[model samples]
Target: MLQMANYEFIRKQHILLGKPIRQISRETGYSRQVIRKALKSTKIPVYQLSKPKPKPVIDSVQPIILEWLRQDEQAPPKQRHTATRIYQRLVDEYGFTGGESTVRRYVRQLRVSPPKAFVPLDFPPGKFAQFDWGEVTVLLQGKQVKVQVFCMRCTYSRKIFVKTFFHQKQESLLQGHVDAFEFFGAVPQTVTYDNLTTAVKKVLEGKNRVEQERFVQLRAHYLFESHFCDPGKGHQKGQVENLVKFVQKQFFTPVPCVSSLEELNYFLLEKCISYETTTVPRSSLTVGEAFEQEQQTMLPLPPQPLDCCRVVSVKSNTLSMIHFEKNAYSVPVSYASTELTCKVFAERVEVYHGNKLIAEHERCLESGKELLQYDHYLDL
Candidate 1:
């Protein structure tokens, strides 16, 4: 290959000095064809390989490595094989005697090329949203505690709502949706999610889900549809998945210290509201501006929000306490040994006798502890 200096000299000789290609070649490298090519263009040519170099050692194990990588596409994200793991497997399982570096280079090449193609999805206003749960660590009253983050992102506007909860229980999940819908001031036509146990009882074949009964009730009350991503395909709901990370990094970074989860949630809510002025990518409109337009197309908020809770029927024991979630709560002595309905919420548990609300108490986090209200036992 001719250096750029040599090529430039040849071109200047013929083009600037008015010298013929034949004379230039004779004066420079004595190659008429090379001189003519340089004079024809001012740009320097970059050399490229006509074919990839051979990998003799890797060629034998190439098929095995490729098969493992293909299988990894369906495996759980954390369980997928690393290049080191693959190299070890090759050595142990196949008794290969190649350098690990060689296997690594070939593995990286296979992973980089032939990138997976994804169809670009476009959502119209009010079409859908994505929901996801993420975990974050925060200092609660000077103690480190891990909390579940509920994230919802509007598909078109990219507006987000984030809240923290003690757990991703069914009640908390339903309440998250309720709060998110109210935050946005309207419900979207559909919401996308992973096959979370709180929402999906069973993941049926291909996108179908046996949604939990409480989750179904939430949808019925709001008049919206629920869509579950395929198993191990978190990318299907990439919007909220990204939001989950964003909240952790942007909002919770440095590990917020608050007196209570309620105070932490207030901070999160303020951060979400402040994001409304931020611009969306590939568009000029701010998130709040886009959300304003989207609100027009969204479904109207129902007359009332859904009662976000889980109901379980339990009979009071001989001690005049009904057991729920391994915790017992007192009811009136008259209602002892009678079947009652317990509506469990994130913050509290309400026990109902027939149609009347009989007892309400703050939900206890620990198991095997009985919560007794003095008023409930006063009639004893």
Candidate 2:
């Protein structure tokens, strides 16, 4: 048992530091022979190797296979010519006499190697957050419509925050982060996300990434670094992926409704808090209590909340109305021809001119044909 323990300790140290057996022996004052023996004796091979055989007849067809692979590089993956097909084509079109097995062996060698994906071994509480988006059908004014849910989760604590939005645009994505951070009462050190186009514009080699300007600004404002998962790897954000289902079942199952987005968000906030108060499976502590403890370890919140909404200049149309989304809002008759900036949020719309609030309208409740009236603007 002692020998086994020593072997495990040394093997683990080797894996953690990625040092060679000779180097480990040199540093630890163990004999090179002993280190080598221990590694050879205790190491469990992941897969057994097959016995080597004489080079096959396929070696002669390597050049042809390589040529065909190169020619098919730009073709669609499914449409790409395979070795078997190539061999058949050669037999039918040309007079080549190569065997199918030989051609397949050569073709296997020409396949582009799959890229290695990064997998984190362990992530500590408040160290990283993973985010993703999910969609669900919910009743809106007795009619069912699809709603997008933004899901974020802390890797270590398994704490989750979910919010529903209409779209997955940059504005919604940035606003989701702000709301998520505020919900958690602290900011994580690093955020992990998939290659969402709203956030990442391009993912360069060596994992060097370029993000949209607004997302970069949002990260800077929140003082957290961003890590993007490789494209086509949704499981890289597994924590949030799991939370998406959890939120859908635990929170959205009954399909609650409200007259406005503000009320819906208010109910969502309450549900999130209530979820945090329940005991997390396999852990004795409630999520809220765990989050409170986690919060102590996290960075303090910023003095001011992030301004996630965007200001857009809108021109009044001939009907003395301004268009925000598909919905129209009426301005004063005197200001019908003037341009004004509209401050849009998840639930509210505020029209302003030089810091002076002109009209505040609670955004339209349902999607189609809804309008914020001129008489309503006068009350504000």
Candidate 3:
């Protein structure tokens, strides 16, 4: 291949200087045939393959690889098979004798596709936030356990809040918002979310949604609007989606060793506070500075935050216990066989008799367990 500059020189020498092709090739150390082509046309010379290289081993497994790639389109993003995994699977299942590099090259060719274009989105300060749930594994009591993480991010300041829970139930979802509002000291005008079952009961056409009743109550209490992304389009709330990965990599790396979720949450809270002082990419001010300015425009906190809980009405059995969520919770003996309201919180369960609180106990995650308070049975 001839450089553009050399090609120009060769053409100029032959056409303008009246130099012969033989003389130009001798002077430039290029072949006579090359000098002739360059003089004939001023275009830069490039080498083009007449045909693609053959892949003997990989060709045999193309169908298998294509099948796997198609299946990956429906699989979870994080759990999709990587190049290494594909190679291992080939060797194990098909006794593939090809080298990993060969398979990787073929896979890369198959995976290449045109990229999608996106419009840049702008959000006003204190007006928008996004929420989502992520999963991570942490060491609790020296044992590895999986936990759900509730993540919220301010679209303007990029401020983040994260908390871990054992489940992604309705109670956890509501409590996450309550805690996040307290952390920000104000409420965003509108919060964005996906079509999560905890928040949305049904997704209608376009942006319309049949929201969960409890979730609507939460919005009404805080006087904030809710926005839900389109079905299967997680990129609509792209800020919080990225925030989930950022927290997982920056905070959850090394698999935090802690005694309980409380200890882990406290550490995470401290980390989030510390993160405010650092600068974000393509921004001059620290996150804390932006957050401070954004706070001025945010809605003021209400006189009281919403009490997030799931209320279940049940009648106490003859055993002076109310069964909820497949577990029996002891109430006062006097309330035996009486109707009571069970308020289930993320951390505790409270039984209320005619709006008067009766029994309170730590919430048990497991089922079929009896949570008996000795004082509740004292009358017996």
Best by TM-score: 1
Error of 1 at 3 (Å): 2.0
Candidates by lDDT, descending order: 3, 1, 2
Residue-wise C-alpha lDDT for candidate 3, range 1-380, written one tens digit per residue: 77899888888898899998888878889999888777677665678989987868888999999999999999999989888999999999999998999888888988898999988787788999999999999999989999999999998898889999999999999999999999999999999999999989888999999999999999999999999887889998998998999989999998899999999999999998998998855679889999998999999889998899999999999999999888999999999999999999988999999989999998988999999999988878
TM-score, each model?
0.83, 0.64, 0.77
Cα-based RMSD of candidate 3: 6.4
User: lDDT (CA) for every model shown?
Assistant: 0.89, 0.76, 0.91
Instruction: State the local distance difference test value for candidate 3.
Output: 0.91
- Tell me the tens digit of each residue's lDDT in model 2 across 1-380: 22676677677767777888878887878777766666667754343447855555655555766777787878888898967798987778765676787777666766758997875556666788888999887777777778788888877677777788877877788889988888888999888888888888888996688888888889888899888887788887877888888888877888876665556667777877777777865679788776776777777778987787767998877566788778888776556767888988766788876677767776664545556465734634
Better of 2 and 3 by TM-score: 3
| Candidate 3 segments exceeding 4 Å error | 1-44, 48-111
Please write out the lDDT profile of model 1 over residues 135-178, one tens digit for every residue.
99999999999999999999999999999989889889989999
How many pairs of residues collide in model 2?
1
